[model samples]
Target: MDYGPWSLVVDAGLIGGLLLVGTLIRRWVGPAQRLMLPASVIAGFLGLLLGPRALGILPFADQLGTYASVLIAVVFACLGLGEDPHARTFGRSTAAFSAYSFAMYALQVGVGMVLAYALFVPVFGTPDGFGLLLFAGWAGGFGSAAAIGSVLGDAGWAGASSLAFTSATVGMLAGIVGGIAIANWGARRGHTDRLGRFEELPATLRTGLVPPGDREPTGIATTSASSIEPLGLQVCLVAVITVAGYGASEGIGLLFPSFSAPVFVLAFLAGLLVKGLARRTPAWQYCDQRTLKSISGVSTDVLIVCGIASITPSLVADYWVPLTLLFVTALALNLAMFRWIAPALMHGAWFEKSLFTWGWATGAVATSVALLRMVDPDLDSHTLEEFGLAYLPVAPLETASVAVTPLIVLTGLGWTIAVGWTAAGLVALVLPFVLGWTRTRRRPPDDRVEAAP
Candidate 1:
């Protein structure tokens, strides 16, 4: 048999092997455990170093980039499937959190574009729309980076994907390390009520694994494994939805030949439709949220590893100066916003809530949870609870921005539209404070805090 069709199997095996190595490194290396970096991230770097870009030792490296793109779409589809938009009501906290989150996005993109036009365009002759990589990488992480990068690439911005992925790697590291530093600083300033001790964290958490006793069942079996495994069913559901999204996207493309939407966006809509349909019938009982989350988690890990491994060294070398300037400037702005603006916007538990936002703005949601755990070990601050309520409204806007921003850039409205967005975000950021909507009251005793999604 020709090895052509089986090449992806080799890529998957390489990723899996590297992940195992990353796990072992985290387990045995004292510094790695202390840093608490995700194993997938570590594995990605390892793959990059050993792959064709560096040592030319890994045959599957070239194929991993394509895998990252597909996995990102799967991750988005699962996200839509598992999300419950109607579960939470809009309130002051919701408005505040949503506004604050959107503001961060705007500020990051706005500042990034201004700098890119002034420095990158003049110095390196980079594309005017290249500045959006800041938002794509820092706020959007690997998934957004891939989606936006692909869009930008198709729009004639060569090497956008590699540069965006590099930015995401830096942003992820910043979110983890910077968040820990901020949490420690908050503890020192008496902003944190519960300052957790490093020694008190379980070895499993530090090493990124759950002990046997700590491993709770993520989902109940809907059917006997002998008859039909739950995980396999869940995977099948995701595949069906993704295929539906592809067909829909193709149909749309036929009508609007000038515009093309990312598959992830369509996949998310498809997932929402599937989820809504399931809820109206007995099928919902078989669709476990936890199982869906697990699928997303797996997709994310694979995506991150592949995305990092796929970075082209020449691209990084070409854009090193601009990438450095963008990263440093974005990091500074995010830190400033968290330290000053976030406190004024959030009420009651400002430190904890702001810290969570800081983590997420820099990396992904997982970083937010990690930082939140530091300041509110028992999760008593209700930051997650309130954030959940806020996220229902925020997520759509976030997704829309990810989807539309590239299109806007493609249409040559890069800086002009970015400025308008920045203005809108500023309004959202400050309007709440002006209207006296900044204060958060304590939740009632009977208020039930939902688990983090």
Candidate 2:
């Protein structure tokens, strides 16, 4: 298990190097997008190449679990900054639509668990059936799986670490394929936005590029003002927010045995909350757009680097059965969902409808951004807004399921099976109706929400 200097690549968070290579490659090619998914794949595969069980060049692969834990927290902080909890502006049907979306997506996790348990437990003969079930959940959740897996290990569930890495890799691959498919299909159907949609015309008053006599400014004041905080201060503010979120989440995990806080979600909420509170305060006004952007990119880049370091190649070889089973199951479930359930549930509002499917299927913020960006680059602000709204309410559910899985196993094997079956059944049978309910003008009451997946 001794690691050599070659392990430095994995140790020094070399994902930046990988990204540089990717950027160079993309530059050589045309103006192709979908960089995140490809970057994720490359990083994951690179881990496999240098991993202990494979080429044995990077025996330090075991450290990836630790990196994933912190990376997840950072990811959550980014999410919080991008979202606004106070808005609660998802319109009348958001709850129902979200409920239905989870239901439909649960089959991917449930069926995969059942099938994997049947195939692997009998062959490998491990007693951690519940751990395997939790693994399936992580796979369905994708990017969060590694973080949740580490949280599981910290809670004394060792099997979860392996399960998390395997599942996360599979989920990333699935998202890439699904995103490309959806983009191609949508484009063929004349649904994708043209480049012109993103082309920004200069405003006479705002940019001075438009003719001066073209139009007169309305006497109304602009809704927002520019904040001029120093870049260093802004960096410190972001750091404080992320640390607060991580500490708060880790503290909460101590209170509940199976409750692992998804740090990314907490950080995201904390950022948004802090920003909202600072609205009237001049101090917060100092935190300007440039500051926020710099903080976000730094955090996101760190997360990606940590994520790449945490993935072990050994899992790819050692847990091939469970990993492959989960991958195939998620793909099959997503296909069924997009083809049958989504169309049935939400007939119109193509943008929201597509977003719902893509977000659930991918379960990664980066993946979701890629999906929306593929549709329209000019739509970054609007898409991020909608996604922020749709994702936050669902954040609790995602975190709860991951955090609670270990506890469910501690109770009894029957409980784990029950949860798995319930989740799978909801996706296969109950999701469509919820979608249909939300698609209508009438809002369905929360009391009518479907059973937990």
How well does candidate 1 match the true structure in TM-score terms? Answer: 0.90
Candidate 2: segments with Cα more than 4 A from true spot = 1-10, 29-41, 47-65, 77-83, 86-97, 105-142, 156-159, 182-229, 237-297, 349-352, 365-392, 410-453
Give the Cα error of residue 21 in candidate 2, in Å: 2.1
Candidate that would win on TM-score: 1
- For candidate 2, write residues 1-453 as lDDT tens digits: 455555646565455565565444433433223333344445445555655545766545455546556655655555555533565755434544555455644444455446635655566654344334333333345445655566556657675655665566556656766666666665665544432221222232112223556764422221243543356565566778889888878798889756666565577678778877887687554555544655555544444544544554554467766556656666676667665554435423444345435654655655665556556654643545554565564556555555455445444563354466556557535643544444443223211112222
| Candidate 1: regions farther than 4 A off | 1-3, 86-94, 251-258, 439-453
Question: Total clashes, candidate 1?
Answer: 0
Question: Global lDDT for candidate 2?
Answer: 0.53
Each prediction's TM-score versus the true structure: 0.90, 0.64
As a whole number from 0 to 100, the lDDT of residue 18 in candidate 2 is 53
Error of 2 at 389 (Å): 4.4
Model 2 clash tally?
A: 10
